[model samples]
Target: MATTTEADIHITKGHEVLKLYQFNTHTARHYFCSVCGIYTHHQRRSNPQEYGFNVACLEDVDPFELGEVPLGDGVNHPADRN
Candidate 1:
């Protein structure tokens, strides 16, 4: 069981939550809640400061789910912000 908490979630911008991957950076390559087939958020390689969110989309997230916040940065983040 890959249970995660608010501390597990990376960042939140507005109403969107940021999720991350330890190895993968491709936003679409990661999967969320395979058991429930839910897609939360995805790892972002460009702005490693936070994960990219699928705002119009989400699933299986409880009402009390951690509100999205900001992430300082990630390990090996791209130097250029372009």
Candidate 2:
């Protein structure tokens, strides 16, 4: 996954097939491909100013190339505590 501001990102193609998913508090907007059911990106609940995008789902991106990536432990979401 990668992080970027909403204004910095734009789906050039296949955006028509993307569907929004909202669970729990519904503050975070998760988007996925309606046809393939692959996660695309999400407006982060932790930081609404940024979006977390699935690198593998994007074009010309090979997640394998980003070896030894560090990720957050999302097992305890801040919203869940509330």
Candidate 3:
């Protein structure tokens, strides 16, 4: 059977808000939140340097406020690509 580890956790936070951005495919941009001491999802750091997706199970996020957004691919680091 497969195993679940701490890395598999969807929701993660630090002392500050993380500006998660995308670098390429599998990597995400991680930053710290300065205002509320949380980690907001952005993109990936090793991916394409863009805010593509967010954690499906985050907190205090207003669905009506955000609306329905599309999803992109983020499975591989840029350097690892051909």
Indicate which candidate wins on TM-score: 2
Scored by lDDT, the top model is 2
Off by over 4 Å in 3: 1-27, 53-61, 64-82
Residues 3-61, candidate 1: write the lDDT tens digits: 23334564343223323335543532343543444565654444444454434343465
lDDT of 2 by residue, 1-82 (tens): 8889989988989989999999988989999999999999999988888998888987788899888998768796546676
TM-score of 2: 0.83
Question: Which digits, one per residue and each the tens of the lDDT, describe model 3 over residues 1-82?
Answer: 1112334535444534444444444455544466654444444343333443334335686545666765436675445667
TM for every model, in the order presented, reads 0.30, 0.83, 0.26
What overall lDDT, based on C-alpha atoms, would model 3 receive against the true structure? Answer: 0.44
Instruction: Tell me how far candidate 2 lies from the true structure as C-alpha RMSD in angstroms.
Output: 2.4
Scored against the true structure, residue 55 in model 2 reaches a CA lDDT of 88
lDDT of 1 at 72: 49
Clashing pairs in 1: 12-68, 12-69
Better of 1 and 3 by lDDT: 3
